[model samples]
Target: MNGKPAVFLDRDGVINEDRGYVHRWEDFSFLPGAIDALRQLQQKGYLLVVITNQSAVARGLCTEADVLALHERMCAFLRERGIELAGIYHCPHHPQGSVSDYAIACACRKPEPGMILRAAQAHGIDLSRSLLVGDKISDLEAGRAAGIPSLYLVVPPGQDEDLSSLPGVQRVSGLSEVVERMFGSQAMPSS
Candidate 1:
């Protein structure tokens, strides 16, 4: 906490309900306990950062501006709750994108460490002390690649991701469990 260790979060599924490339504010919904979890982490003095991949932009489902607008909406919600974000980094590129400008194999995409690394540089984050929470394997991979010490997989109950073989990665059923696992259940979320 003294050195600006960050809690890097994936946007979809981790923060918002992932209803297939959700880009509009109307479609956005905070996952249960996400706000509380984030508030708890923030109270512990961890920088809250979001690193996500929005391939929907590449597929023309939405524009980059739409993605930014969605992030603004998310931040607005957090601000209303008295929480602040350190940074929001997203990659709109896809290797097989329909849009030529985003078609290349970009390093910012998840499973790669570009976005997280860049955010660390921009926000003075200590990657060695950082933690990442994501809902998928690729999210864990990105944290591993970025040299983050911890990775938490947020999977629903009865779902076995079978990722136990991986070192330093733990699985949690929800964001509340994420805060519990890292900081113990006694660490209550601040209002």
Candidate 2:
């Protein structure tokens, strides 16, 4: 990596509660320790990039403007907590989607590396030195495809405990654990 390492975050489950088709600010809720973890990462000199898949736009559950509004609110909230997002990218396509224009499969989806690759190019990021924090298998795959060396999978609340079978990825209970693993205990500020 030319610069400091980066942490690419998945929006829905990693940053906010994965309420299905979350396009409205009213439905957004930051998960426990999310903002704190982000601030920690930021303090450690890690660029924070949010990469998400908003297929709900394709399903017509919400419009692109709604998604932008939601992101604006999310960014503002994070800024209030002293956390700043380096960049945000979201794919608004889904195969077999309800909306005719957005129904086709696209390269920016979770399983695809398009979004990550684009972010890397835009920000001059080195994927091999960066990490990805996500809550799903697709996120891991996308990170792998983008050549990121480390992938941290967040186990959702009430989900099964087993993670032994998730290959080539590290499983963490939450974003705090991820920060500890990536930045180490010494990287944390005194509480």
Candidate 3:
């Protein structure tokens, strides 16, 4: 397949509420308008891929199976809304993790770009034509390292960090604002 443009999304905060270490499906809640925003991007022919850091697995708060189960449920939920994700890549490793198997510095972790790089290669994505939306600086760093041209930082409610220092990164309130920035002032209908 010839390369195609994609939108790399961060799971927590950007896709759902970052309710610390959310492993159970019950705890997972999609941020308002996330589904619609993703659907709009999909309709525009951009592959939707999720690149996330599931360090809870490494910290022993949850197992890899648990994370996979949550992802399955999340994907099913999106599928019901006509939004299909091309791929979901997660890093279950951390340097100071308690789980012996996962307690090591890994390339796939955010700020490293391994997951984004793998997704690009796996899906034949054109990094130069793709965009990334994430809530953390590490997420943008990974996107930059992987050569994504556009980087959007979603600042969730109740948290405010001075991001004026980061050049080339666009700050957005949420997925709704992201869609607005991408498609202009016209409003998108929710699914």
Candidate 4:
């Protein structure tokens, strides 16, 4: 394991409420205490990397530039909270997408580990020491494939999904809880 650890995050559901193809800043909303959790992770020297699947681009719901704009807004919001992300990786392909060229089985999609592997290679991140926090089982599976030891599943309020059947994956109410588990009592209070 590398001395420095990284926190790989899922954009939708985990970082923000899964609002269904969030392609605009107006549609983006950060989950409760998410900024704080990210900042806490940053304070602990963990490189914050966002690995997300943006199939909306391929489905014709939005364009790549639209996704980038939303991400820019997200990064700006994080910056206001004093959190700097190391990198943001997104996969814009979907097997049954509407776009003419993007409709194909792509390795970069979630559950494939392509995005995570690419991020690891680009950032020189040690997967064994990294933690991946996501809201779906596919995220955990990708993390597993990428060799990320700590996998956190975030279940939002009123969400009926249960992932207890998955072994070696920890469940959390939100990113805040994951931060607590990672930093223990030493975790700083969110501003």
How do all models score by TM-score? 0.95, 0.92, 0.95, 0.94
Tens digits of per-residue lDDT for model 1, 1-191:
23689999998989988899999999999998889989999998899999999999899889999999999988998999989999899999998989888877989999999999899988888998889999999999999998898899988887888786677688888778888877785788456
Tens-place lDDT per residue, model 4, 79-167, is 88788998899999998999978888988888989988888888888888889999999999899888888999997667666666668
Would you list the clashing residue pairs of candidate 1? none
Indicate the TM-score of model 1: 0.95
Ranking by lDDT: 3, 1, 4, 2
Which 10 consecutive residues of model 1 have the lowest summed lDDT? 182-191
Which tens-of-lDDT digit does each residue in 2-45 have in candidate 3? 69999999999999999999999999999988888999989888
Off by over 4 Å in 4: 1-3, 162-165
- All candidates: CA RMSD (Å): 1.7, 1.9, 1.6, 1.4
Q: Each prediction's Cα lDDT score?
A: 0.90, 0.87, 0.92, 0.88
Error of 2 at 18 (Å): 1.1
Q: Over the full model, what C-alpha lDDT does candidate 1 score relative to the true structure?
A: 0.90
**TM-score (C-alpha, index-matched) for candidate 4:** 0.94
User: What value of lDDT does candidate 2 attain over all alpha carbons?
Assistant: 0.87
Q: Which stretches of candidate 2 lie over 4 Å from their true place?
A: 161-166, 187-191
- Residue 26 lDDT, candidate 3, scale 0-100: 99
